[model samples]
Target: MGVDGVFVAEPVSNVLGGLACLLTMYVTVYRRLGR
Candidate 1:
């Protein structure tokens, strides 16, 4: 069960982490351009 849980959590964490990174970059870029 621990291994299965880790497997499931990994993909979800990756997706959320990717999304957070994208959002952070987008906001930073948008702020810098002042648009």
Candidate 2:
């Protein structure tokens, strides 16, 4: 028999998005400083 896939939910979508933005900002700053 084949296995079935499962579904997951994330209620903190905005929080995750904010975290991503912060990470991106940090990377940008690091690159600018490294140059």
Q: Could you tell me how far off, in angstroms, the CA of residue 1 lies in candidate 2 after the best superposition?
A: 27
Best by lDDT: 1
Q: For residue 11, what is the lDDT in candidate 1?
A: 100
- List TM-scores for all candidates, in order: 0.79, 0.63
Where in model 1 is the C-alpha error above 4 Å? none
The clash count of every prediction, one per candidate, is 0, 0
The regions of model 2 sitting more than 4 angstroms off are 1-11
The whole-model lDDT of each prediction reads: 0.97, 0.73
TM-score of 1: 0.79
lDDT of 1: 0.97
Cα lDDT tens digits for candidate 1, 1-35: 69999999999999999999999999999999996
